[model samples]
Target: VQDNLEGALTEADIEPLNMPEMDRDELVEGESFKFTLLCQVKPDIELKGLDALTVNRELVEVGDTEINAEIEGLREQNAELEPVEDRGSETGDIVTFDFVGTLDGEEEPFDGGSGTEHPLELGSGQFIEGFEDQLIGVKEGDERVVDVTFPEDYQAEHLAAKLAHFACTVKSVRCKALADVDDEFAVDLGHDDLSALRASVYDRLFEAATKEKDGDVREQLLKGLMEANEIEIPAALIEMAQKQLQNQMGMHLAMNGMPRDQIAQAMESETEGVLERAKEMAHRDLLLDAAAVEGDISVSDDELEERIGEIAVDMNQPKAKVRASLQENDRIHSVRGEMLHEKTLRWLEEQASSVSGDSTSASAEGNPTADDASDSNVEVADEES
Candidate 1:
């Protein structure tokens, strides 16, 4: 009877508010048993003020200075390095040499203080201050003792702001030949001419800027929606979101080449910080979910299949395989939740008015902050699902 009741509730798409309470009567052999079951229904949510929200939309303009700087960056990327046998080291030259550094009153060189055949760009500021300056005018086979002081905030505690002497030897020198921004350079880059290259760069920059601005607008809309609505989020949901946040952070760290052990250590050390972010994320999620319900936004079966197909294409996996993987991992609901969230945001955006004269102009060469880029992808709380 208990099994039948549970199965029936699941089939009806009903979830108990808490574990069901059951009362049973003892029965003799071949006699019927009696039982009473009690369950609580989910609470209804009332969402308000979604249609009256206001959000600012930013209009971004890309300037010529930004385009010129982008072209210069391309030139730098394509610059050729040629051996410089006729001259000594100069600013902007790549110099190869060996060096050994020692502190005052030290008999042997310090740890990580020596190297051989190290290639460094003279004006790149890759070494300690004044170290590269002393390398200027040094020719092949020239040896000298260079003196420099480390900054007070150096990573190594013992060497911070300390004076040191480096025994350096010049091995070879090379200079870069930067390509001119002309028609010929455009041809090398697969463009018809300089004008074509410039147009392409402008288009890409404009697209990036527009995307960044859209993200800001979306965030503002979400913030407005959140401010207008107040809802109680379940503790269970918060815990799940926190775990999902940790997993995402761990994945990000691993993707950036952090070792597994180090990633574990980092997660351990950042527990409170991660939990705080998780709580905020979870709160936003609950608000979005309530709005979705109130607005009657939902993901259809066909929509889910379409989304899965797109993911398969992006991941270069077979659609059937990806579908099976999602089912096996019980993540189909997570995708559905993400789709619902997107729909809610779109609905809110339609309801809100974009404030005029709030547009800001910025350089194209400068990258957007992490907050600006955060909306490029929507991270669903898969664990919560």
Candidate 2:
């Protein structure tokens, strides 16, 4: 009957919801249902030959300045936090203290806090605004009471704008980091010496930087394609993206030990913004798929398997387990979409002419835009709401 035809819908070029024929039936009790109906047909894109497409592969050059920065970063990561026998704790030094935080006349400590060896770095601004600054002059074995008011929009409702007193007893003081950036340091890092270490580090840095620059070019190319191309995306896909985004975010928060109540609150606060982001991203994806078809670029089965293996390696999981997880979650289509996007980006690079000489490089140290100041507020809203 109509049910059998509906079951075969996926086998056809069109989806079950987009089938051309409409069928209906009425039961004995007079209850009736529309059995099958195809709303519309999907548009097709004409393909071009690979010989007609010309994509330029970019060459990224890294110099001494970039090498030095890379080496410094690696040294920092491998840097040891050693104790200073003579020097006193400074702005960046770690300060171990036993503290009792109290509100009003009550001497009770904050929940999960009190008489503990809490590590605080002066001027880190990790605690309340004035909390760490007040301990600037205090040395080891010193006892003091710090009085401060929490921000008006603090995360904890009870602590918001509340005047509080923290009775702090400094247990020990640790001083300046004496990092060894010498040939001996390189030997300790499993290298022969400083020169060999620098060379190796430089090579790795150039590879990483070149790859990153290429990724940026690819992103710009894909974004341009998405902007130029126009297509109506299925509403089902948008809804799915929204729900998937929510679920993924929930899983991320759960992995970070966030409670259910906190996750629910975060979702309620972020739903609208998340949906908007998802909608834009989904539209971009649909346009890219169309572009992939138009360019006749595709990923093979081997390419897909290679991609899956790479993702599994990045996640520190076995390939079999990752494959099983993807199958169980029915995310094979998501993987195909990812491959299609990559192919589409390659196609865009082929179509467009790019002039790449040299542009002024922005420092990675500072904030990217003025809008980041507003983003800080949004982040607070996300955390507290």
RMSD of each: 10.7, 10.0
The prediction achieving the highest TM-score against the true structure is 2
Runs of candidate 2 with Cα error greater than 4 angstroms are 5-8, 16-25, 28-34, 38-61, 74-88, 104-107, 112-115, 315-318, 358-385
Query: What TM-score would each prediction reach against the true structure?
Result: 0.71, 0.75
RMSD of 2: 10.0
Q: lDDT score of model 1?
A: 0.78
Candidate 1 worst ten-residue window by lDDT? 376-385
lDDT of model 2 at position 39: 60
Off by over 4 Å in 1: 1-44, 86-172, 357-385
The lDDT leader among the candidates is 1
Give per-residue lDDT, candidate 2, residue 1.
Answer: 56
Clashing pairs in 2: 19-38
Model 1, span 1-385: residue lDDT tens = 8568888678878776556678879968999887766766534567677777888776677756566677778876888888887777889888899999999778799977899999999989999999999999888888989999999966555688898999998888877787766778879999876666776776788778778887888899877766787666666666778989998998998898766776777788899998888777877887887878777899999999999999999999999999999999999999999999998888887788877544445445433333332222222222210
